[model samples]
Target: MGAGGGASATEGDPFWRRAAWVAVLAAAYFVAGRLSLALAFARLAAPTIWLPAGIAVAAFLLGGPWMWPGVFLGSLFVSAASGRTAWVAVPIAAGNVLEAWLGAWAARRFARGRAAFERPRHIAAFAFLSGAASATVGAVIGAASLCRGSLLSWDGCGATALTWWLADAAGIIVVAPIVILAAMERRDRWNKEKSAEAGLLFASVLLIGWAVLGGAPASRNYPLDFLCLPVILWPAFRFGPAETALTALVLSGAAVGGALRGLGPFSRGNEIETVLLLQSFSAITAAAALAVAAVVAERRKDQEVLQGSRRSLEAAVRERTETLTKTLGELESEIARRGLVETALERRTRELAHSNQELHQFAAVVSHELQEPLRKILTFGDLLKGMAADPRREEWEYAERMEDAARRMQRLVEGILELSRTTGDAPPLGPVDLGEVAREAALDFEPLVAEMGGNLFIGPLPIIGADRAQMRRLFSNLISNAYKFRKKEDAPRIRISAESPQRGFVRILVEDNGIGFEDEFTEMIFKPFGRLHRRADYEGSGLGLAICRRIAMRHGGDITAKGRPGEGAVFAVTLPV
Candidate 1:
């Protein structure tokens, strides 16, 4: 389990889910306690192997510190129900919780938490820190509690504590690895090959253990426990920490059962000596198996890494060869194609030059010839209206219409001339204060905005390398559109602001509460003569936005617009600082 596994399960989980896991942990602890007690010597506070110690350590390591309540409750209930004094159960339960906490803390700090079995150094640290050291806490407290409650003679307290400590240590060395590694084992690790090998390995252990330590085989009790070493070494070499742990545990059960019946090598000693001897053997065997498994696991990982690096190098070489072959063919084709491209490019350059000359000629014609006639028309129409004897007559109305047409023609000609200039050349750039330009633009619309009960605000803007006149025109056109397209029922609310969105560029935003356009017209509205409303409803040559876009492009900047049907619109102009 990783740090995220325990933390997320404890913190992100709902109260009921966490409670259910705690309940399950408590139940398992109690049941393991009962089974451990069944193996205890009569009238003694020591068991051959206290499996619940392993359960507590594994719980704390996997479930995190929040699982302490479960350990406490389980210990309290089991101790009290075992006919111990009710008050004695309190200190014993506290001792169990402390032992688990200490073990988990040490493992997390030095032994790699629940991953202690993965490497040899971490396995050694776990053995010394969690298994041996933490077991002392529970042993001392439990023995003292029993003696204080008058349940055991003071003379026997020291022997009982020694037995308790060894039993707990052995339990941690053997059972804890089984539970932890089994929980973390991936389903993909078990296949036909591994399953068959594991089955064979475990079967050999059980058979060898029964032959060397079984009570029924009286002739086999010849102090030949060393014969089991070969069976224990098999899983250590072939399998992982979980499998090795289980094999040691199985052998331990067989050996202990036979010794208790006075039919094994350990049975030659007195009862306490026999129990201690068996525990020492079990702890040493389990630790050695886990350490050897860690070493083997490390070797396999190194081999896999070396093989992966070799494969990657070969694949890279093959890909490079293929790329070189393909590039040579492309290079030959490109040389032939370059000659044809040069010929076409020369022809297009000539056409583009001719087009530019024609555009300049058109601009001169519109400026000198077209506006003169529109001005004469406007002057003559006004004189005719003054000469009409009856101003309300039909002739006077016709004169008024002629004057309006002439004025509209003048504005259209000027707009066309402006648009032509924007496409002609890049304007000279300078550090122009955009805040001052925006405020100047806002001043032009102030009276109209005030009369209509609307607002126009100019926010702080950056001094950017831009053409001052073009920046002014950009702000003017955007603000004018905001006012013209506003809803009649609502007062126009417009705001201009700027922000540095990236390292080198600043974005200016003009937002308005107005009658916005459809999404499909976001691009169309930037083209010349791209009008959404009719001429009678809104007066414009539809060249304002087109001119704004051209001005932005000349300054190495851009303008974009976003809007909904009626909610509002935001026009963003991004320029380099």
Candidate 2:
């Protein structure tokens, strides 16, 4: 049972399977080599052709070094079948095996791993090193073996060695790459164009080969063997190495067969010389075809790589463009949203301004209405005073107080009306001489200036765009304030001057020697009804400064005040010219 199990295990092993394949290949090599030798055995010195050397090298390369035994067995069978003694057969077989081993080694070492002849340089190296150089070894050893066995004379050994060497070399150059490449070729389906081109190439090579070396007596004079090269080159450029090598093999076989029949260009010489010439042609043709095919394959591979890179770059650019376009769309949406918000804000501001204008108009109308009622009260109180004279002291006092209160109320109404009118709508503005307006204000206060024992001075001013009445009222309010808030012991002195502090605007300065207040109250004095002094101390409504500021602001200008406790005050009003 243990022996039975061992037999089953050996049968199942992968090594046995590989060995079976090698045995089958060796049998095929023996048959092919014997047949080739038998066909060209006209001259023993020149066997003319050897196919098994190429077969052995290709088998070792494809099946690894373990296939060397197949080469030895194949060589031994072929030599022994040729009717040589064991001594001659053994040495010749050994020489053949050594040649195959050497060729396989050179191909692996120099032809770039696995003998993949995909470049011109690699193809050239394989043809020279593996085909020509390694075959010399077998040729020398086999010729020596034949001479020792008395099968060949030493005088003819040189010629026999030369013929053997070239025949083996030609066989390798023509057959090895074809077998290797065909075994490893890609299994792509042949399209219609490729099928058509291949059909044409094969037809042309056959026709041209027959015409040039058809073993016909008339063919030698034509010398048309060169015509077959185009057909060989056709497949080299368009197909892979396998097709190129196959085409070259077919053409070479046809040419050599014709020469062997003594009807081609190489048949003009002696038997040995003729066969050598044929072998040389076959070797050169095989090498050239393989190299060109490798170059074409390399170029195609490079083009494929370049096209792939270009596709990737284009895809990246498209992706980036889409991202940028999306970002730009978002920015546009944000800008549109901000614009809508600004429009809403502007609308609210206009509505508020309209409401303010309506309030000012209403205030002016109400002040005018209050003045008539106050005047009636004052008239009635005065009449009562005159009628009750000398009747009672209390009656006289009450009547006098009534009249004073009525007069104060009247002044208050007038001040409110003036302030509203200045701030509300006014007539269109024109060019007015501000210096003339200042002089008019000063003249109006001349009587009061003289009575108070004070001096009032006016300086030259610029012509500005303004309402004339409004400009006069603006200066009147400022000058009156200077006169009203005077220092009793100082004999108040007031000066009004104008200067253009900057382009497009003029500044009017009203400096006074008056009892000024704190600097902190500067902005406070401009508010409506804002007063630093009690009514009993100043004897007028506190709306004067407020009205002046309103008028200046309406003309696109402003007014500011500076003052110190005991020093004088200066009011600067700026207006656009």
Candidate 3:
């Protein structure tokens, strides 16, 4: 039986549990001692015979190291009180003490988590090794006691030594293993699901019971000898030799009892080979059981590993399916984008052709209107040139101004027509490096900004799809306005910044240190011919800003401005991402 983790729990466990076990052992020792005595009086007449009944088994099994006192003292009392040679007592006591010590030492040394009497390699190595070693000490002391007192011959002492070995081996094997097997089978806890124990315990009850019954028929005088075989084999498979020795003790007692009473058919010599054969049977059975258990455990481990690999493969398939779903979504979006671009191109081409036709009609109407105005201006100027010695010289000057107004109107009309047609067929959207566009535009206006003693700061920029020439125009127009409007003696500072809020869009900002305007004029500035300052003060056609707004709308973007009087103005331009 094997167990791990923690001590198995029971009611009032640990301290009380240990106390209960020790008390039970103490009670069993005394009771078994008394019973052996009563049984002895009914048979052998010597009480010393009762000494083997429980004292040896108790000392070897429960007492651990402390069993020496009970075994040795108990033996001293039993041997002296019995009919053995009066002087043989002390020597026997020494042998018992030595045997107890060896059992304790082996328990502390080789015993593992398996029950105390669990099966070790050899019962002799288990029993006789420690038993033989510690018992040798007792035998030597006994021999010395016999030699000094002259109570027995050297050969007789030698025979007594052999008898002592028999008794000790008997107690350690027959009784020890059975008690340990019972205790182990009593244990319900296990490391596995507990099949190993089920097989062993089931076989233990069957084989050992058979041995007890069959041994009786084999030697009617010592039929108990059959019981010794199962007791020994049980320890080999279910327990170690400490318990085996205990099993051995009960068998020895029974064998000796049956032989002394003339109840068995066998003579003493027949029992020797019987002893050797039991060991052989135990050795083979123990070896086979252990080998089978090892193979089963190994096979179980392999099956678990294969199952884990199958689970991992299933998870990888799920991840691959998710990746394919995302790819399909992107494919769908691409198809929709190309479809929209085709519809927009067809619609825009028709609008452009119609606008061009209207422009031609507008030019003709403007040309006709301008001819009459120019003729009137000429007639007035000619009248003024012919007014010789006239009192109104200021009137002649006013007529000259009329001709100037007509020439300016003609130039404005031409400029308006040019603005409508320019940049109408700009290239399709593509990845445009906005930073490169800003730098090139800045360089073109470098000479002008230097002349005006202005500073231009280009902030962070991002790239997007846009026409490069149109971007250059947008930047040039904003910078020109800022430079021209700078406060007297104040440096013009232009800062350009761009942001990409999404993958396909960009926003560019142009801010300047110049003479700013009021917020009320914001909408007015976008209208044609709308100007905050007189044309005499700023040489502009007032159409530059209106055309800038139109170009921004055509690109699917827009421009707006915010300013505080006497401070500065900032123009925010947003383009499609």
Q: Poorest 10 consecutive residues of model 3 by lDDT?
A: 1-10
Local accuracy by lDDT, each model: 0.83, 0.81, 0.55
User: Which lDDT tens digits does candidate 3 get at residues 1-577?
Assistant: 1111243222244656545544444444445445445533232122212234224543454435444445555666655545446567766666656665665466445553124332334333444444434545555566557655665566556644554344344334334444444444444355554567545644554444333523345444444534445545554345333333443444444444444343432223444333323322322322332232223323444665777777777777777777777877787888888789978987897787778757756765675676677777777776775673353677766766776676666556654754554434555777777788888878877777777777787886877677766777677777777776777768678889987656666778888878889999888887778889977777666766676776677688888988878888988887885
lDDT of 1 by residue, 297-321 (tens): 7787788788888889888888898
lDDT of 1 at 248: 90
Reference-based lDDT, residue 544, model 2? 89
Tell me model 2's lDDT, rounded to 2 decimals: 0.81
Write candidate 2's Cα lDDT for 175-237 as tens digits: 888777766666478899989987887887787777776555666677777777787788888
List all candidate RMSDs to the true structure: 21.7, 8.7, 11.9
TM-scores, each model vs. reference: 0.56, 0.61, 0.46
**Model 3: residue 48 alpha-carbon error in angstroms:** 13
Best model number under TM-score: 2
User: Top lDDT: which candidate number?
Assistant: 1
